[model samples]
Target chain A: MHQSRLTRWFFQNVGLASALLLFAVLFLSYNMMHPRGFSAAVAVQNANETAAIAFLAMAQTLPVLLGGLDLSVGAVMTLTNCIASELVNGSPAQILFGIVVTLLSGAAFGLMNGLIVVYGRIQPIIATLATGAIAIGLALLVRPKPGGDVDGDLGWALTNSVWDFADTYGIAGGGDAWWIRPFADIPVPVIIVLLVTILVWVPFRRSVTGRTVYAIGSAEGAAFMSGLPIERAKIAAFTLGGFFAACGGLYLAIQTSSGNADIQQAGAYTLNSIAAVVLGGTSLLGGVGTAVGSLIGAGILRVISFYFRILDIDPLLQPLIEGVVLLVAVSFGAIRTLRVKNKLDLFR
Target chain B: MRISVSNENKPILIASLFIVVILLAGTVYTLSTAGTAPLLSPKYLLQQLQTGSFLGICAAGMMMVILLGHIDLSIPWTLTAAAMTATAVGGEMALPTALAVGIAVGMLNGFGVAFLRIPSMIFTLGVDTVLRGLMVAQTGGFAPQDTATPLMLFLAKDRLLGIPVALFVWAAVSVFIIVMLTRTGFGRSIYATGSREGAAYLSGIRTRFVTMGAFVVSGLCASIAGVLLAGYSAKAYQGMGNAFLLPAIAAVVLGGTHILGGRGRYIGTLIGVILIVLLNSVLSIMQMPEAGRQIIYGTVIIAMLLVYGRNQRVTS
Candidate 1:
């Protein structure tokens, strides 16, 4: 009986498990095809790129868990990138202040979205769609063109290896340096990702508010009837989404070492995040999935592009392939709909 | 479960009045500043009406999809794909081929949503991305060399009497749509399916067929809009249809159609289309930057949604 139960759990989490496997295979293949052969610099560069979308995917997961979608997350990320680029310059104190303000602004955008949805009675999709436009407008206003610098020190610290082990041990650069190889392999972005997963997502997952979010997603009427503080939970979920979106923007700024208010990029991120969430096994209808799943999903999506590059496929076909992948992944989730006893339940 | 005709007409009536007020206000502002009311001039108004016709056609289709509580985000790419196909296939075969492509895509969307049980939003979005990629692959990142056919140009840009032929085509299409929604059993089924899919199914409405039909109609309208747009521009280009998606949706929602489906009017959407066209013209006249324009466009949708949404909550 226990073995059967374990098998059931494994099947239930098949999406996440498959995603992990896909990610591992893709990463390994990419490393094999890469000329550098799994060096720290290469890993850090790839990790930095993956971290941005991963953070955005994580941001999107919370609202999806609450049965709401936040289309403004990408716009918030763009806005924060613009804010950070404008303010995260000069002295370290100044950069710290800029980062704080940028994060706060992201939270504010989320608060506005929550209020509009909860109080204005507008649907989440439409509300966030509007706010997303406004956020993009704000981003454009902040950075009319893409040419603002962030603090150099902060950028280097976040994007580089944690320790320059070869230099620390007085070994010359470009040597086989076996002893310091593992130390140099630790990318700062990867470490930050781990820290966030442990510090934020793990605790949040076990909290009452988090449980309430899932409850609301699963069945809002039942949650409300049971006095589950629906409003507070929703607001908190959206706010945290904004916070994470800002983190994504901050990472983008660090990685690029500049800022851009490109609506195309923002729109792509929003769509990709949704795709990632689905890839992660999170139900769009809400109430299931985890942050780890989203991380893996993000990794899978990023690696797909890299895998394509390695295979020498035309770059133009990327969106087409990605779309097919998304459709197939989402359809997997929909298979259960076929079993509904009543056709009407299909609409629900 | 049927809404009274009078109740349905109320929102349209109010929207029409609002459009008149906006036009007059814009005219006054223009006249006060420039000593002439160019926007109110018959010629300019007629020209703007031609532009509004494109959006009206697209919104007309969107209204049907929205009526069924599903959205077709693939409109932009579907339109683009059709236009590119038509233009590339130029000459007499252009119009029919373009429309056929739209219908094929629309049917695919419907099949996925109805038979495959995939969510309309994601499914259509995926279809859109695929279409976008196909178009890009076809064009190799440059504007197509083929020009719009003479017939397309005549339909889109030529005048009949003192009015644009586009306006007449839009009128014909709108009239047909209005009849479909009001005078046909299929129209009633659409509303029923959107309002309560299960009940509609139980009532033998063939909800899947209705859903597919709505999508097919939407796809047809979008393709027609694309053909017209190609005619206006004289050539189809990459990303040409991108500008229409949000505005088409915004116009439909602004017309007070429930975004969740089951209630709305074609007249309201008509008025909504005119308002957006006029607003765009006025904003252009004022020389507002693109960023400011987007902000206003988004704000307007939100304001209208709040006003309409509040009423919905109270009634429910």
Candidate 2:
């Protein structure tokens, strides 16, 4: 019984451990390359990258949890950034307002996707793909080029420092701040990622609403028969996903400090978001995953990229590795699903 | 015997509608611009047609996969791989050899999906990446300088008694696919497997093999596309196939082939590819920015899907 439970747990939670392993490897490797590098600074940078990817993955996760995949996450991210830049302009007030607008835009997009999937009776993949294209088109209409500045002072304020020791550069006591200028101090995106975990993921996944997501993911028809708000939960999941993707875009805007359509156009976030979620032991078939696992997954990907950089591997090789990673991850998920289905069939 | 509209006619009707609308739009725009030059100058339209012909050729392959309710996301990379292979073979090798290699790759794709039981999207995507890496490694991240055989150049550039030879190739391939789809057992198998694999399998069809065959056909189509592209350009580059990816899928989808696999026709894809080519040609004539063109491209495809969806439910 214990062994069976352990196997189930491994299938369910292997993603987090993978993420942790990735983080540790990347941490050590990055240090090996830059021996004099500030550990805290690297950690902070890793966190920021993690938050952005986590949110993006979570956004995609909602649809997947419902046995749907959204291919338009990349387009949505680009569009959100473009709209935010146009709306937010260069004021601090605009920044705050932009956040709201971005989330709302994501929600609006998600709502449309949900409605189509439910009412149009189209497959979720197809429906979401069309919606994603629509969102991207809308984004293109807003910003043709990657030109727009966030309020520099605001960007700095948000991305810069908190305590005296932790400026945009590395921490205070870590040698002259001159050597660490490139690796700026505590990133706000990381803080937001942590807060989101505490606020959104913790209570939500544990709550009835979260369970509804899982139940629906496990079996939509069953969930519906059991009196769950199937359509609403799907909409909620997608909406939250859009909001998170938007949040990712916002952080990306800060990271690059400018808005270009091509920023993060590498398609990394789209694939990685899915990978991270799956790696975090969130079933690709959906209805099973944790934000913490996603967080870890995101960290692992970043670490992998960092390692590639450290090892001086060709940029193209990264995609190859990612492809392998995706195959391995999905294969694992597929085998597990096959096992569970078989076991359940035995009872029948 | 009452002859009700057969399932085949549906794609025909939709394709006709698209052709009419696109032609009308093109004509109207041409008329509006007639004062500057002849509204539909043969030279001008021919140039536009030629420019988008490459995309049309590729969409032909991509559409077949979609008809099977599977996608070759790696068309982009496959295109790259074919180009690399063709470029390496150069003008000295017989066209048959180059063509054979391309077909082999397609067969490999079929094997991966049908035999390996992997998802088409992920599997093809992996193939695309691996091939891209191979291409980059082979060409060292540069467009290869290759000399096309005289035959290739003639095929790509020369007209056959006033019609382009490429047009001949297109016609032949289309007829082949159309017949294979409508007349052959394999074609029926493709539709059956895509629309309802479980039922098809129970009915004694080798669904896995059929799915695999569809992928091989898809690969064949992509490879042929590469050959045409290489011939047209006189050489292949590392990223020569990059732009073909979205539009190939778009053409297939727009042709009214269900993105989810099953229940589509080659005719739909053919018209869809033509429509997209014409649209882009017209847009470029208007001097639109590259980015704006992308925005418009995405919007138009979505709009087409929405319209197609409504019609699909009504008819089905």
Candidate 3:
């Protein structure tokens, strides 16, 4: 929303509100009903599960905003997770090196997608689908099974409470730790998520390349006519998307402390991320959304699963609920089309 | 007349030539490695067609939706749900129940894509998730623990005069689609609608009905395949249809059916299905691993699409 007056100006962007508002309501209600109300430990665990999908939804957000789709984000994550599990072990230096390699591999997969889509001129859906298949094949070649050792200490340090790191780094200053003690129980993954948002997404959203991405999504023809960097922006969107997917993959490796080369997992994550993107108030037609909205949408999805788990509902029915959520959100967006009086206007 | 026909059907002719090349390769590999001429053996070829029948049927449906410039991503679970429901119903009701389930899902897909104006890819994908959840919940994450009805067995396994009945089933669907595309006004309208829905609507095409009809046809095809698969296995199970999903689409696309929906030939699709079937069996004969098969499978689809799709440089 934006308003201008002679004396002052006011603006509010409600695009990111749906997912945030829904997640906030669902999260608070669930916390209220929980056995332990809003503990940092609980908060951390929620973040750990939500983080991977959040990263994935954020990944999906870029392509959707570019008026394209990436069905391979899950596959890329799966590939990198296997790589991380296989390499992120042994000596500390080896682990550090492995982590870098793993992250780079994710970027490489995204880069591959970008190349295929932009240079090869393949439709994004088909391009991503093909690349995704290759990624899964590679993942299977790497692990071939569900078991791999992520360094135990590393996984624990990353997944568990942040008390030790805070105290050691003296985030509260060297004088006293009392004020920060309560928050010390906050999980490292949650902080990593926040840091990623603040450090990466925020800056990217404000960048010229990001503006180009939005412009491309809204109207590629117009963007091209205006002499925008269409090819570079598209490639950038895919590479960044792949990088985020890799973050998801690494998180999975750390969270599970192992890796699985599961084909079903790739399909599941791809579909769910899409649903999250849709729920996040991003138009599938492209050109209208934010990573924050996608992040919140992801949170809302994970919360539905978590809330049901607390209620002790049958695990089998969980997907049904999630699917219904996706259907409703998708249809909710479609309501706009129904309002168009002229049938011809439907296409535009 | 012959020259004009050849020019119009160039893609199909190209794929047919590619099929021959693939067959030659298979023969060379088989004879050189296995010391067998099974690639050309009538018995072997017939058996392969029987296996291809299911994929052929599914692709037949997928091609219809794609022909309408829409995709049905719900095929996998729709097939499973149909098969599972059929087995659960059993006996005389099995066939009807399977078809009914498919029709219902198709109608929902049609409603969303046609009337609601939602994109077919995501809408059907959403429905796919819902179907998977419902099936898993229905079976409680285990096998359906049901036997194929006698009708399914007759349809899937019982050979007719030495050729598998499955081939006949595939043939029926092929004939129906060919007739629909070539012999019916509805089929022509599907092309018109796909080429440009607004133009088709303005021309009084009732484009929505055509779209819904295509989806319903697709659903029925998937349902038929599901029933046959369940019969072949003699039981219903979860995720049984997962394997067919992409291969079916691949077969359609490879057959020279345009992914963008409007221009394609049924004959090209038929040949494409045959190519996929032979390639798969040949790969197994060569003792390729599952992982390698997946890589080649994806590569083949992309390679074929690149050859023919020549997509416009736009994100949408």
Candidate 4:
């Protein structure tokens, strides 16, 4: 009985442990491929992709938890990036202001989504789809083409390593910069990602408000009857989603060193974010989830993308793979939910 | 079951939005185009109506599935398969035979969605990929070299009494669907299943049949749309169906349909389709870049959704 219980526990928690294992394997593979100069810079590039994807996944989680999905993350990112590039007026302060405005805009967007879902009584999917179209349209108005450049100094600072910490000590050597060179100097985006994991994810798991979100997601009527502020929690969840989307946009700007309104063209982010959330073992039907799971999900996605790049697969074929992966992930999630639904009155 | 009636009542407010969007599209085009009067021009509006009605034929069918709380993401490919099949086979046989083949493919889609227990969205998406691949492989990513019969071209190109034939087809299908939904046991079961699955099951609704029926209808609509479009464009090129997906969903939503299912209006969808086509044409006439046009389209739709939802709440 003890052995069986232990084995079940391992099976249940294996997702996260294996995620870390995959991350380690990715790094090892990279090292083996490039024997002499495989270093922190590569890790930083991977970090940047991981951070952006992670942030987007996190943003999407809140709405999905409430049985909603946000298709507008990419569009919102485009809008923010467009503004950051054009409205910054060539000053760091202005660029910072743009960043602030972007987050505010995201929050406002989320609030609208929540309002529509809760008060407007619109279906979450339809509401988001409508809003996503609007967001993309607005991004187009901001910059028809990918013309505007972010503040040069800010871009350099974000992308380039200033001080040699581990890399300088020869632990991971700093080298020439590529368009998406891993941040060797300061790696601010990765830092922000880590900070979010600590501050947001941890609190989200521990705090009452956070727990209530899970409860609401798992069973809204029960939570409502139990005196949890169901409506507020739902609104807060969507609003938080908006904020994270904005953060992801900022990280994306840093990664590419410029924002293309069309960069969000690929529908990869939306599906990938959902996949990441599910692969991290977050329940699709909402309620049971961990932020750490999303992180692992994000990591796995990045690794897969990197693996594809290393293998030199045609870019177009990637969508087919992504579509398949999305189907698989959703299938797994749906099955899991169905299994739980059979036993749990919570589904009602 | 009683509660869903109240829920269905909510979508009536979305009908009002169709009016708003149409008016908005009209107003925007009027102002931006510097008095083109294209909005009032029957010929121009007829063309827009015909283009959108091609999509409407499919939307009418999709609306049913959506009302039952499922979606058919594979309309793109179904249409593609229909188009390719018709175009490839139209040469050797009469048009009816080719159309039948296309419709049969749609039946297969219905089978996959209904009997296999696959989520319609995922199942269709996968099938869409396979269909797209088949289309590409068959045509080598270009229009086939079939010398289309004059009858085929005339069917595609000929306007009946100044209105496109496609519009007539669309009108017929829409009416057929409305009748089916309002008058049939199967249709009522769809509403029941969508509103509450457990209750539907308890009521002895053949939920799978109801669900599968929607896909079959959608498949049929898609093929019809493909036939119409293939006639209109004179070829069923790769990704011809791509532009239709968003607009189709938008038309449904704008028509007062709930994405979660159980409620929608066909007339509202018709209006939604008109509004979208009008918006797209006007935006193009204004020389907006692709990105700008997309952004504008997105913004207006989102704003409309919010307003529609809020208004519904206030009225209740």
Candidate 5:
């Protein structure tokens, strides 16, 4: 606890730094290898595709930070994505209403998870698994055939290049706007990711509830002894996590201009987000890591998919490569355990 | 120490009670509609048991890991890979190859989880994905065309004493697990390690070995189930194992093996598997849509857990 400031900073930010570095390296490789090489369109398309998993990772980071796992985040994403598709079309007002409804539904489902895990005293993992199954069922009922659509205009705006979006809205960053030139090609999803970080995560991390969540995760009994509002902090963590997952779903709807309540997709998203969180350096044991690291981790994961395509690997081998890369990436986390001589230290 | 072990018997008792309740409810619903006690009929009961055997096998290994408070998420692809390996080899070498695939996967899983100190949940998940990739690569992305061999089919489908061969296999596995648990040092170590890893280690137990051993058992069980499923279906395919993972976990947990680990009985898991199979049957008998069935399935698990699993209350 009394470590020097420089040493403390390095150790504390190592996960985030490594994640950022990995994302930079992998993404640069992808960009360099692409035929379109460094084009705004390419960046936006990648960002749009990566946005869903990023948000899901963001959602997963919270429960993990609170010393729990929300296995329902993916199911919530599917549910909200289905709802968004059904309601995000038609008139502007209708689209607005639909978006809110979709997001709120995610919050509600998340709250249900919180209630069950906290009040019902069930393990967060199993509890979320059960609730997630129900949410997926709801998603299926909402979109049995998967043909719902997001409003064409909204989808286009979010999925397009930032410069194009600026031009359409007559914003200052339109063509030849010198001040914003460097950011002109910035993807809307990138902006959205920043916006979420600033609006939600920054505030939460600075707030009392967020600190309490960390305290509880690191040592629940000690946190309780310290008289923290453990239950509320947990509920808040879950509720916020759900909201993030909903945003992920909304992003999915916008990115695809439609919705799919496919079970496989749900499973994939949940697993991938956890992978992202793990890669981001968040301890599954809880209490250590940042959402930004997870977002960067998610980016790294998505970049690998593009890397496969860019490298011209056989399409059949993509999944295999992806799996191997993930395994290797996560295996890095295991190295610290190798140095321990005493078997009892393994538990810690 | 001399006190009656009433608490130890609770899980089995509860599972048995649920079995009866589910049966009665299914019977009542069926009688009111189809006018046939299909739920009570011997043929239907036997069929449910046969279908449940695969899950029972999966749960048996899962129970070992769960007993140590860990999980094996690789069951899905382990089953797939085993089936694929067995069928791809086709004949005298089939069964051995399939079991070998399982033991190898389990060994890898145990190595990572035990030696590497990676959480079993994520490590096994990664392993599952890799296995899926390998299987997909082997088949060149399309479903495999290989068929289950004669002996495989016999083990999965043949019957004697008017019972399904699968039932006998399940019984054999169950007997093996029960004996191992009741009669071995490694078995006691599972419960001890689960309750407290540090203490288990301090007490001179090789907790890592126990952890690895549990994962190997789970992998072997998953492999067995994979072979049986392949035999039952006449071929193996990707995602065929998908339906089994969660349901197997649900069965093991439902049987009162504490999800967090340390306490559970194989008989309870058996009852849990039957209860689940019957529950699904009842849902189909009532003509519930797939969505409705899922909703009810999730609800039932939560409700049951709430009843027996809510001992660790919050805000206390």
Candidate 6:
């Protein structure tokens, strides 16, 4: 019986498992093709880029867990990035103030979305889409052009390896030999991701509010009937989502050392977040999956492009591959539709 | 078989009134500032109608899908792909090529949603990405060399009896759609399926087929719009269809159609199209930046949804 339960757990988390496996294989292939096998510099570069999308995916995962979608996460990230680039300059005190303001503004946007969906009774998709438009507008207002500067020291602090092995050990840019070293020496962004997973996600998953969110996603009517705090749970989930998106924006600001009001980039991030959440085994129908899975999912997505670059494949084919992978990943969940005994269940 | 305007349609009635108010507002603003003729002048109104015809054609198709309680977010890429294919083919084959591309995509979307039972939103989005990639690859990330065909240009630019031919095409398409929804059994099936698929299936309606048919119609309409758009611009360009998706959806929803499907009218959608076109012209006239325009569009949709969409029962 114990063995059966273990097997069932394995089967249930197959999406996460596959995502991890895919990431590993792609990372290996990329390292093989790259002139520098797995140097610290390369690791830092990868971590910095992946962390942003991973954060956005985590934000998306929260809403999906509550049986809703938040299309505005990407826009919130863009808005915060713009704000950060504009304010995160000069003195250390000013940078700290800018970070707080950016995060608060992101949360404010999320609160607005939550209110619209909860109080205004608008559908999540449409409500978030509307708010996303507004967020993009705000982002454009902050930085009409991509010319703002972020604090160089802050950017270096976030993007560089926590321990500079290259400088300390006399290794030139931590040259290709340290591929086998543990991920402990990974970049600060990777550390931030780990911290977030342990600190924010773990506590939230165990808390009553998190369980309430799951309950609402699984069966809102039943949860409402049970007198659970459905409204509070939903609002909290969206607010948390906004907070995470702001984290992503901060990462982006540090990575680029600037801001851009590029709608295309925001749109790409939004679509990719949905794809990552699905690949991570989170059901779009809601009430399933975890943030860790989405992190791996984001890694898988990023590695695919990285792998393509290593192989010198045309960049145009990247979207095609990504789309196919997303469709296939999503289709895995749909396979259950064939087994529905009652035709009506298919609609649900 | 004419379904009378019921109490549920009061929102649409109010929307019609709102359109008039906006028209007057736009005219007054234009007249006061530039001392130009009112935008309500026949020539200006005709121009606005002509511009609206492009959106109207696409929205007409979108309305069918919305009526069935499903959405096709793939419209932008599908429209772009069709336009690219048509222009690349050039000459007399352009129209047919575009229509074929639309039908093909529509069928693909239909198969996934109806047969495989995948969610339309995600499935169409995936298809859209793939199409976008393929189009980019074909164009080598640059504007295509081929331009719109002679026939397409004539259809888009030439006028008959002082009205744009595009307007006439839109009228013809509108008449067909209105008849399909009001008089045909297929139309009835679409409404029945959208409102409640299980009940419709139990009553011996082919719900899957109806669902597929709605997607096909939507795809076809989107492709036609792409052709017209290319004709208007004289050439196909990358990301040409990007601007239409939100506007098409907003028009459908603003027309008082339930977002989850079942109840709506083409006449209301027609009014919605005019309102959007006029609104676009006014915003442009005011020289508002792109960001302001997007904010206004989003705000208007939210406000309209609060008034009309909130009350409808979403069976899906």
What DockQ does each listed candidate score?
0.51, 0.25, 0.56, 0.35, 0.65, 0.48
Best-performing candidate as measured by lDDT: 5
Task: Rank all candidate structures by their DockQ, best first, as comma-separated numbers.
Answer: 5, 3, 1, 6, 4, 2
Model 4 Cα lDDT, one tens digit per residue, B28-116: 66776585566667788787777777778777877877887777777777776677677777664636654675566556556665554
Candidate 5 residue runs with Cα over 4 Å from true position: A1-7, A170-182, B1-5, B314-316
Model 3 scores a C-alpha lDDT of: 0.86
Interface RMSDs of the predictions, in order, are 2.7, 5.9, 2.9, 5.3, 1.7, 3.2
lDDT of 6: 0.85
Expressed as tens digits, the lDDT of each residue in B231-273 for candidate 5 is: 9999998888998888888898888888878888888888888
True contacts kept of 1: 0.52
Better of 3 and 5 by TM-score: 5
> What TM-score, computed on C-alpha atoms, does each candidate reach?
0.92, 0.84, 0.93, 0.80, 0.96, 0.93
In terms of TM-score, the best-performing candidate is 5
Clashes of each: 0, 11, 1, 8, 0, 0
Question: Alpha carbon lDDT of residue B266, candidate 3?
Answer: 90
Candidate 2 Cα misplacement greater than 4 A, ranges: A1-8, A11-38, A48-51, A86-91, A119-122, A157-187, A202-216, A263-294, A312-348, B1-12, B36-49, B94-101, B288-296, B310-316
Per residue, candidate 3 scores C-alpha lDDT tens digits across B44-160 of: 999999989999999999999999878898999999999999999998999999999999999999998888888787899989989989998999999978999988999899999
Comparing candidate 3 with candidate 6, which one achieves the higher lDDT? 3
How well does candidate 6 match the true structure in TM-score terms? Answer: 0.93
Per-residue error for B101 in candidate 6, Å, reads 0.4
How do the candidates rank by lDDT, highest first?
5, 3, 6, 1, 4, 2
Q: Second chain of candidate 5: TM-score?
A: 0.96
Better of 2 and 3 by DockQ: 3
- Candidate 5: residue B36 lDDT (0-100): 86
